[model samples]
Every structure is written in C-alpha cells, then in structure tokens.
Target: MYDEFTIAAYERNGFAVIPALFSAEELEEIERQLEAHLRLDLASAPKGDVVFEADSERSLRCLFRIHERSVFFDQLMRDSRLIQLVRQLFNGADVIADGTMLIDKAPLTTYEFPWHQDNAYQFWNPPDAVAVTLALDDSTAESGAIVCLAGSHRESILPHQPSGVFGASRSLVTPPNADEYPPVTLSLKPGDVSLHHVSTIHRTGPNHTSKHRRNLGFAYHTSRSVCDNAAADQYKRDLEKFLQTQ
Candidate 1:
C-alpha cells in the first residue's frame, strides 16, 4: 500500500522506490516462469515482440507484449495491489495497461539504454501514464540499474530521435538541465520496485559486473490519457521494419 509520503515523493520527484513489492519466494517462482519461457525457440515467439542485445543470442534485450504471451504476466498486470497503486497514483481514475516488457541486461555487456521519456515514444494526448520496474535480481549501479532525473516529468516532453535500436529512442541531455536535475540511481533487491511518470527522463549504463540484471516493467495509462492512433500505428510499422532487419 502507498503511504502519503510515498505518493508525495512520486508527485514531487516523478518517481519512487518501493521495497519488497514481492516476496523472495514469489520472485523465485517468477524467475522460474521466465526461464520456462526462455527455453522456447526464438522463432516460436511473435515477430517484433521479442528482442536481443547485439551479437548476444542469449541476452534478451527486451520482451514486449508479455501479458499477451503468458498468463502469469497477465495476472501480474491485473493484481489487486498493483491496481490499487495505479488508481492511487491517478487519483482513483480507472487504469489500463498499455504495455509490458521484460528487459535483461547481460553481465559484462555494453547495453546502454539512452536517456529518454516514455511518453516521447508514444506521445499520449494528456500524457497521463505511469511505469513500474520490478527487479528480479539485485540491481546495482554496476549492474545497470535505472537512473532517473528527479522531477523531470514536470517539464514538457523533450525531443527524441530514433536510436537505430528497434523501438528505442534517445534524447539530448541538455534541455532538461540533466546536470541540475540530478540523477537518482534505483538500486533494488529482488522483489523491490521503482515507479515513474510517463515523462520521467531515465536511462541505465551497461552491466559491468558479473551478475545479470533482469526486470519486469509495465506501463499503465489512466482513462483520461489518450494515445495518438495515427502515430501509434506508424510506429508499429516502423518497429516491424526495424525488427525484420535484426
């Protein structure tokens, strides 16, 4: 459950870290489920939905549309506690999940996620959206944990350019005064979670340590936030093209 201070921190800083969102045993079961999914042939996965890090066949870069692929992920998205958090964040408004992703940052790999805002990629009309990343492994700065610019969501969405990585976008570190905003690294243990607004500027470095970093991320949008259908469709086409080349 979200306390008043937690909600206020999220409102003021555009993000908050919640410890023990899941228990250790629950995390173990989730990892087991994910490993079962991973054992399947890549060709069996929906095209353009799963991605890998460059030249690393075993390094899962991202898995999109996870709720559609697995009942476990779908249940996670619909959990009562998660629903309550979403409603609380959005002032009791109805919430719907727009996307879910599983990201893996392989150990000792250079897989940097460029700084960008979530809404910049989708460009929702009212931009009322939230994202949560639940750490499946102990995430540290050395293992590519996410770092966000505190309170950056208060500013308008910044310009983003295609980063040549499928479905990935990058932003300049100048406009929001990245130096002034001060980055907050979200170091989380297994079952810990971090939540951020749609327009929060965030990124992570490569995993330089020996431990693999894995997280399940979900994006939720309030009923009041509407996506630009045309842009969304066009993005899908572009994403398809990019994935085909990978």
Candidate 2:
C-alpha cells in the first residue's frame, strides 16, 4: 500500500519506490508467459537498433503490440489493483492506453533508456500526474534500474533529450545546469513498485550484471484537459481499433 509520504515523495521527486508489491513466484510466472513472445517479436522487428538494448542479447518488446496479444496480457491489463491505483493517483477519469511486458534489460554492459517523459502523451488526466513501473524483478542501479531527477517535471516541459545527436540511453542534464538536476537511484525487488510522474525526468542504463533484470512498465493516463487534436478523441473511442491499424 502507498501513503501520503509516498505520494508527496512522488510529487517532489517525480518518482518514488514502493517496496515488495509482487511475489517472486508471480513475477517468475509472468516472465515465463512473456519471454517467448517477446523474443519472437524482437527477431521480427524491421528495425533492431531502435528497440533492442544497445549491446545485449535482449529478446522481445511487447509494449508496441500489446493490444493484439490479448490472450497473454488481457487479465493482467485489467488488474483491479493496478486500475485502482491509477484512479487514485490521477483522481479518476483515466484510461489504459497500452502496455506489455518489457523484458530482459539484457544484463551485459550497454543498455540505457534515454531521458524522456510521457507527458507529451495526451491520453491521461494530464501526463504531469503519474504512471506506474511495476517491478517484476529486483531493480538496482547496476542492474539498469530507473534513475530520476527529483522534480524536473514541475519545471519546464522541455524534452528531456540529448543535443548534437543520439546514441545510447542519455541523461538530459546539460552544462551549467547539470548540478541543478540531481538523480536518485531506485532500488526495488519483485513485488515492489515505483510511481513516476509523466514529467518526471527519467532513464535507465545497461545492466552490468550477468543476469537479466526484467521489469514491466505499466503506463496509464486520465482524460486530458487539452483540446482533442484530430485523431485524439477518435483513438480513445476504440484504443484497440486505432492500434490495429498501426
């Protein structure tokens, strides 16, 4: 369960870890259900460089195609405990945009997620609220767990991205202001969770260990106050329909 402190931490830091939210056995089972499908998806993607970990024997990515694989993820997607949290944090009026098992942060030495926020996304009460990162495995700094800037989200909506060019997972910290952005490492084990605000500046680096640290990132949102820009409302009328065409 979460509390005022937990919510406040998330508000101030844009992220906070919730301890032991899933059983090890449950995680193991979920991974078992996801591994094969993920591997197959990775092998078939037209662009390998964009998705797979920069330098690791990573398998599949399910987030891109979760709606189609209903059998494997349907019940989990409909999880009441998860949905309840979304409603509580976003204060209801939210919906599940999408999700899938993000597997094998391929423990090696070269995987990292670039700094970015889902805030640009229009599916929620406002991306500024929060999203969920449910750990399916033990998450640690060395294992390529999430690292977040304390409260960058409340400031500028500037893209937390790199300049010059793109390469690997990058931090948005820049000169003269890098010190202004302090990042904290979140350590969590299976069953534990972390709530990251949309504007929460965050990223992950490659796993330096020999074992894969698999985690599932469950992204959520509430009906945004912004005007519906073209396909926005239409897409919500049928998330699956819109996705199938993609």
Per-residue alpha-carbon lDDT of candidate 2 for residues 154-218, written as tens digits (9 for 90 to 100): 76555333321222222355422447769888887887888887777777777888876767666
Off-target runs (Cα >4 Å) in candidate 2 are: 39-50, 53-63, 101-103, 120-125, 160-178, 225-246
How far does residue 93 in candidate 2 sit from its true spot (Å)? Answer: 3.5
How far is 144's C-alpha from truth in model 2 (Å)? 1.0
Q: What TM-score would every model get versus the actual structure? A: 0.93, 0.73
lDDT of 1 by residue, 1-246 (tens): 689888999999999998998988888888888888767635577867777766736567778888887788888877777778878988998998766688888788786788889887677778789998999988999999998999898878777766665435445555457676889999999999899998888888889998889889988988998889988888777666665676
Task: Give the residue spans of candidate 1 off by over 4 A.
Answer: 170-176, 244-246
lDDT values for all models: 0.82, 0.60
lDDT of 2: 0.60
Clashing pairs in 1: none
